[model samples]
Target: MKFQVRCFNIILLVLLLILIYFFFYHLRYIDDDGEPIGTVYITETRGRLDKSILTDYVKDKEDEYFSAANISVPILVWWTPFTYDTGSYTRCNNNNQARCFISNIRKYRDNKQFSAFLFYGTSFRLYDLPLPRHDHEQWSLIHEESPKNNYAFSFESIMNMFNHTATFKRHSDLPLTTQWLASIDDLLDQTYLIDVKEKTQLQTTENLAPIIYIQSDCSTPSDRDLYVKELMKYIQVDSYGGCLHNKDLPENLRNPVETMEHDEILKLVSKYKFTLAFENAICTDYITEKFWRPLKVGTVPIVYGSDQFQDFLPDNHSAISMLDFTTPELLARFIHELNVNDTMYDSYRHFKLYQIISNDTLLARTMSERKWGIHNDRVRGNFIHQFECLVCERIHKTRQDPTIKYQAKFDDYGCPPPTTFDKNGEKLERSGNWYRSYEFTRCQLEVFHELLDQKNYSFTEKDINNAATKRFAPSFRRNEFLR
Candidate 1:
């Protein structure tokens, strides 16, 4: 009887502990640091989080908003942007997207929850610089432009909506002015390139050595092709594997078609002499992961980006470039000679091994920094905080709005009705109704909230729920090739 009693007590204790653990773990609440913040949550569905590029984006965004333990409002991100109702941040045509944003705000003014909104994109300069900001008004608007070059600027048309003021300046402007504002540093995935395991699995002597590679997509222009062709001519395609241009191929040149599932490309790099690392456009800081993939697989990279490469890369790396060799024939001859001479060939491999070893410390440090403490401060000033505070303020105000109808049938469902045309009182169905409507998951709505909250924009859950349903449906004109 005593033993039974003890067992019952033990089981009760275990269950109690579990209950306590979950209760605390599931609770989401705000801290009191007063930083304006938001979070963008990428969906883990489709096993998409495994890819480095997408993972880096999500990590960078989270770190940007939630850093410094600064308790502010939280905003969640959804992966598929098309499904969510952007609320006031709708994407109209490329030139008219900003106008669409303005129009959305006007349409939803009666609903106090959606007074502010935030939208991020790469092409800020093209949207016509110098956005509007109001002074010391709660009904004011705020906009943030994140340029592709790892930097952003904030303008507050509504100054009262911000806890702290954000200043705007140009890239080429004075150092003092630029320094006064916060610097938007990139949350780099420092472990982007690591690991150097050599593979011994060899099937054939011809396929033994990996070939140098360059893949040009279908969208590349003729001028881009000319540049690639010129580089390929210099790299000596005959000696290396082959230069790949999916669309246009010369008769003498054999097409280099790679299998999608085959790590053959990576394997080619590992066993090959060197991989060509040419940029699609020079002077652009968008460092494609192509440069690091070869290095991660224990292969040498011949790089050709801007001087910014030096800004981001380590010094004294032995990677060759278009600037290094005098001519294509000379480069080809050198590569051929290295292929025949085992000593010279092995020396190149040793250089690659040394490169990997040299960057090991940096790689580990970057990974740890990303994992902890890096996102400890919020950089968007107090805009999000103020907006969230204002939202709470509005919610209190609306509770007393005697004229406000809380229970109104909103167009929440995303499904659109068929369009009809009338001629002489006869209704006719509009042509081209085959296109489907867009769908949104719960995760997307959370992200849209954060993005708008960053702009000090507020909208109701109903408004957000409605906006999440618009899909990216474009109709081609009869003259267009697609049509």
Candidate 2:
């Protein structure tokens, strides 16, 4: 009886040892709920809070896709100066001691487990600190809103947060690119086309006496002052802003910066037949609110910035392009004709029928269709939220594929200087004397002679093109393209 009892005790001891081994194995390799785990560390930089908010947002997004069978969740931890000492900060249940561990940035720098390093373009100067050596498996995040020439980074991919599409520059050599442009979704919802149509019909019937221009910038690289002055000759233009102050607005509306924010500006614009929508500087795909506001208010926008303005319009007739005419006089004449002819004017408002879609919808459709390779469509979005979501998604994708790598040469992509095109849709050389050098092309000379004929001023095209350099008063330069 004593021998049998000792044998039973030994058998129980063996079973206890087996249980101990299995428990330790599971503790080391498995997460809560016995699922395998992966972790990604985001750096704590100037935009750390925004990044954290985005991380939580992505978590909420993931929860929407969660399933009962698959409880896998990627651990997103913050890597700050404190993280270097205490490791990473992760939430832990009071009962699960084995599942919690402090993560350190220094340890992770040498360890290949960290997923990505997000670098904001504006904070590029802070990169002197120690960071992980360039790793093929990890992602390097860089985003820029403007081509400010101050950006410095060695990135594998780029997120362009400009107000234009990723294909705005059309550089084939650019690295893997993502776009996060300005979102007009909220703005579109606030605007009502029904009221705009009513206002437009009333104005057409009443025949407003003067066109309106609200400009504040007295100086600009785009020669807007000269163009506006020349346009004023063919028709009366009531200048409201500081550039050519013929009329003073109320004290509350005197500041362009403040007035532009409210709908009061659009309200004032709706009373007019046309509004000048000229950009301060001509950049590829750099259309801003100046162009969009007039359209929202049912006033025809005389646009003069991006050569690709037609692409953003709901229809070709939605806005008039400054490039369509050879001279400002011709454009002015066209606007006059449209103002007098109500039917012709009403045709421009046809786009009011279709409601504008959010930037998110446009982007998803563009990506699904793989249409980023072409400039066929306008791309805009809620720049902040969409950009953060995109970054998070890319990081998750890289975690799944450890072999992924990207490296783009900086010279392969850039914002080149804007190109000048004549009315015939041909590029022109920037260098040469203005009216006096006969450097103008045959097409330009023909347009010049036609303008002169309209004014009943006879001048041989060859003589005018090759006329000697002559100085004119600043006012004359503003009121006339050539004198």
Residue pairs that clash (backbone atoms under 3 angstroms), model 2: 87-103, 87-104, 88-103, 183-381
lDDT of each: 0.34, 0.47
Error of 1 at 38 (Å): 13
TM, every model: 0.40, 0.50
* Candidate 2 Cα misplacement greater than 4 A, ranges: 1-133, 136-210, 353-382, 406-413, 418-483
Per model, state how many residue pairs clash: 31, 4
Instruction: Report RMSD for candidate 1.
Output: 18.5
lDDT for residue 155 in candidate 2, whole number 0-100: 21
Q: Candidate 2 on 1-483: residue-level lDDT in tens?
A: 999999999999999999998876445444345543333333312223334433443354333232222323332222332212222223222223212223322233333334434333444322232332343333233333333322222121222211111122323222122232222342244353444345556555754444778898765545476677777777778788998778777788887765674667766776776788887656455565677777766677889876666656645677888888877778878887887676787777765545444234433333343322211233422222232333344445556675543443433233333333344323344411232122222223344435444753444434443431222223234544332
For model 1, the stretches where C-alpha displacement exceeds 4 angstroms are: 1-26, 29-119, 123-131, 135-204, 207-210, 214-216, 220-224, 231-265, 308-315, 341-356, 359-483
Of the candidates shown, which would achieve the greatest TM-score relative to the real structure?
A: 2
